[model samples]
Target: MTTGIGQEREKNMEYDLGAEVAEWMLSQTGAPDGARSTTTLMGLQWDVFPGVWHPNPGTRLFTSWLPIADGCRLLEVGCAAGVTCVVAARGGCTRVVGVDIYPAATDNTRRNAARHGVAGRVEALTSDLFAELDEDDVFDVICSNPPLVKAPESRRIDTATEQMVYDPGYELHRRFFREVGPHLADDGRIYMLTSETLADPAELRKLAAEAGFTGRVHASEAIGIPAPVMGSTPAVVAAADEHGVVRVDFTMLEFQRG
Candidate 1:
């Protein structure tokens, strides 16, 4: 079922909408290419890497709804800028592990952890999902604000930046559910961030069910973002905001092994 945005995002389904939004956001901030920079989010300063996904509204919403507890072990997959990892560490998690496919992203997490004085509680690893994690490494809390936009392989740009936006057939989402059970403590909880503007919640539920997990919407909110409009190129830029903005429905899905 859809909320907030309704059918607005479906208007530009043929275009690479995820990349368009990212480009518009980057252009608005004038972030230099291939350079490291710092920005503050969730009231904490974060060191952002060139190709890493910067924390956005969805990221913030997920963190706000995250179920972290003191002394619990936490794991954040696709921890681009390590925002969630640092947040968990500061929240009193005994150990917070942040994993990403990009080495630069892992380094960026380390930098942010150090900058925030949580280095002692955080470990940054370069990994694709749980590949590098030990089979016995389990956590009380496992969370990921993964790439939600659904696009075909042919349409994907395949950069680290784009990887943060497009899931390309929901392969990553499928893998996440299929692989997560073994790494979660019996009482562990899993949280995933998704949006109606970018994905089909029903399909996600099917994937989760296939992997033996029961899921529910833990939290949801409506957020406005730049609308996509027909242009010379397929990209819907931030400039389109002058025309109007579209409301995107963001949701945090809670899952437990069935």
Candidate 2:
């Protein structure tokens, strides 16, 4: 289903639309490609590059559940290559904005939106979470496919090449919740994606709660961890094995600011 869904994600897990995730039962099988130089999703071709997050299963699941509204303002957090943002704009959002810490992501998002014929409705910016975001630019809907992997410190991390999937102490996600509050409209909703490898559903809910928001599992899939993915970060695997976690649950979370 996806070669490399997210830039920080190195696991070659794949997901098909409309498939019952339970049926897989943590099956680790081969996917199309790990590099994912080019791919197609939701009937659109994408030019994905290294260091940019690809549209993984969590992404597809979240986007499929997007509460599309007429002329609604939409925001996509951490839009790596602008795949989901482009989809939202093409689907008829009045205006769509994408934000990412990586300059490549913003550049690609803008270029892809234009390529997809939605440039007028799409704008992308390079920002660390909400730092560069304008105060008055509240969005009716927000989506995130954040990096959730708990990468071992020794694992190679190159901002120009690879994003750290390891949250260390889940700090990145925690910061997202803490900083995302002000940018959300009064009646806005957020659809976010993450994996069990980093945090469980209950833990995710608690994190959101601490940040003055309520989050729940909206869509989920059980992914089997293969040898290659496990080997990429033996330290993380060892940690998970210590906790008896052999399977990763890919989840989509829906929450909102009150």
Give RMSD to native, each candidate: 4.6, 9.9
For residues 128-224, what per-residue lDDT tens digits would candidate 1 score against the true structure? Answer: 9999999899999899888777667566563555666667788999999989988999988899887776666788989999999899999999777
Window of ten residues with lowest summed lDDT in model 2:
14-23
Distance from true position, residue 170, model 2, in Å? 1.2
TM-score for all predictions?
0.83, 0.73
Clashing pairs in 1: none
TM-score of candidate 1 to 2 decimals = 0.83
Candidate 2 local lDDT, 159-255, one digit each (tens):
3333534454566777888888887889898888766545445766788999889877677776444434444344434334444444556788899
Candidate 2 wrong stretches, greater than 4 Å: 1-36, 151-164, 223-248
Worst 10 residues of 1 by lDDT: 230-239
Local distance difference test, each candidate: 0.78, 0.68
